[model samples]
Target: MVDADQTFVIVGGGLAGAKAAETLRAEGFTGRVILICDERDHPYERPPLSKGYLLGKEERDSVFVHEPAWYTQAEIELHLGQVVVSIDRYAKSVRLGDGTLIEYDKLLLATGAEPRRLDVPGTDLAGVHHLRRLAHAERLRGVLTSLGRDNGHLVIAGAGWIGLEVAAAAREYGAEVTVVEPLPTPLHSVLGPELGQLFADLHREHGVRFHFGRKLTEILGQDGVVLAARTDDGEEHPAHAVLAAIGAAPRTALAEAAGLTIADRAHGAGIAVDASLRTSDPDIHAAGDVASTLHPLLGFPIRVEHWANALNGGPAAARAMLGQEVTYDRVPYFFSDQYDMGMEYSGWAPPGTYDEVVIRGDVGKRQFIAFWLAEGRVLAGMNVNVWDVTEPIQKLIRSRAQVGPEALSDPSVPLESLAG
Candidate 1:
């Protein structure tokens, strides 16, 4: 057992930081574990914010990870509304916003990513928001609720997960939603045009207006409130509010300032971590969106800003920090809830590797599984409303299972039966 005086300081109070502290207690670490977060709100599940919370289907407290009493019982110190400005490596301490020096035996940096800004004009308008923190979601939810009085239009910039989800959520609330994407298809960079087309159709069925191959040139505002937006295609989208869900950049400034090594991800920005989830400084560990951890399937570091990644990554990194030798390398997984569809995707597939996708059911009926294969090997599987295949698909990815198209397309063939 670690001495009660020994401190493990964690930065950022998102899913990652909370999970790490929870895991520490679970693993018999009775020493001091302090979670310092900049956000004053309690740690909550982020997935719900894009779906249920935005649509008023879930209350704010429903998404909370741990109650206040649980943290107290677990002996985890909560430092709410604390911003870590820098780290003093030589002093083995962190400098906070209020000039408090927090010394640590080991530091776990869960300083999650920040929303990427839209470089266009009028981005600072009152009704223009970015979906990253809980405050933003609540503020937008309130704005969406008040839309009954206004023209009730929401212009979402970028067609990424956040944009698509909020667009779907707003449409659910009977608000006019428009999505602007520079790519020919939203999520084209990852899911390809065919799958992306499915999402476009799905949203269109929900009455969402989409502008593909268009960029936001400017956001027009009246009295510092977003009223309209202009696209690169020379079109204007009427809006009561605009959400810039373009993307996110890792919050590595403090870690880098402390002389910690950082690396650029292939598709995003963040400090690079090894397979063990340790940064350049052995004593300092990182996870969540801020730390680009190694993915076994991709054979390189990936920064996945998702609830599952953070929840799982936090514990894995914490165990490694305790010299437990825990490996976080699992088949990459992500889940999304759009409309009534319950979706889960796994595996690493390079672009152009999947020319054919074998579907087990119908897309319109909202019951099916799509398998992305490269040649004869299973590259990835996307379960749409059907979750029965998740277990086998996960095993397949781990073993790099090679199955024929006939087996994949046949619903009668049990996925587990093909397990090697």
Candidate 2:
């Protein structure tokens, strides 16, 4: 069924699109592959943007998904720093910002997401930064270094993963960091109160100040430079720089303009797609953060924005496009490295979904595995400072087995055997 005459145009050159292009070639698809990116940089992983790269632990060139020569070697039409303005679905063509149009037999949207901007006053100031791109990270790295050198203050909004990671990085540079969060604790929505408090304590131990249960009301600045951040609680915190790590919204403008069905806010507000990653238009597929797929196991439309999803979802979409039987049922997985702690979380267990959180090992020592369960069934597992357990944890979730708390909390019990 493969033909050399056919062409596949993939919009967005993040990990998902790049991997999709790689999958097409690997799956023996002789069709022409074109990858488009709005950013000038090559496809790069984002974790390093906050973790290693921002901390100066990783090289600037280490973030790219593949070497620059690899795309050329694979014969992928790499269109860098070019924006696709419109998608004429009916004509099977996309119009770029430069007034160039390209026809395609199939189209893939991996547009990903953008950082939610701070809406308060003075957000447009010079010291206000958002971490979502390589360029943003590059600028933030310099900001952290300057803040550290001058013993300046950095005020961060939101206590989510990005905020916390950057807080750790700023502290590593000996910069004073203050986190203003609307929630009661860090990562409250995802990890619940118990684990959230643990993270709050962890950051506090590293000399990070947390103004919990407060939201940034406005940013105070002078001459287009940030001075301080005012919270809803009538407290103004002196800040040399401010990082808005509130969250990200899926980049769905292109898909929406193309008359594609977008998921509601409850389903991640992304481009709605089936398990096969097919959009409303059968010929148009989506993946990565932009695609909200109806999950087979979860029985709900879910969009995962983590690196693992992009790493796997793209290849799955490519296989589906190749007319292969595909089910993108991968359990949502994510990892975080903050300060001295390294953690991997597998499966979904949002606050309301899980009834009890059982912990194994020592919490004070910060070496533990926490399992979230609903009616004895393990919904999610987070291993902190633990290694080689993600496979077993995922198996436990996929098996949908009723695991006992006693066994789950026992270090002697093997997780793999429990799944069996």
TM-score of each: 0.96, 0.98
Tens-digit per-residue lDDT, 50-116, candidate 2 = 9999999899999999999998888899999999999999999999999999999999999999999
Residue runs of model 2 more than 4 Å from their true location after superposition: 1-4
Candidate number with greatest TM-score: 2
What TM-score does model 1 achieve against the real structure? Answer: 0.96
Q: Model 1, poorest ten-residue lDDT window?
A: 263-272
Clashing pairs in 2: none
Candidate 1: pairs in clash: none
What are the per-model C-alpha RMSD values against the true structure? Answer: 1.7, 1.3
Candidate 1 C-alpha lDDT tens digits along 1-420:
347687899998999989999998888887889899898887777888788888888888888899878988887889899899989888889988999998998899998988989999998889899988888888988888777345499999999889999988887777899999988887887688867888998899889999999899999988898789999978899988999999888999998888887876674567778888888888899999898877766677778877778989999988987889767786778888888777898876645867677788788787888888876778788899887677888887676667888988889998886657
> Which regions in candidate 1 have their CA more than 4 angstroms from the true location?
148-151, 353-355
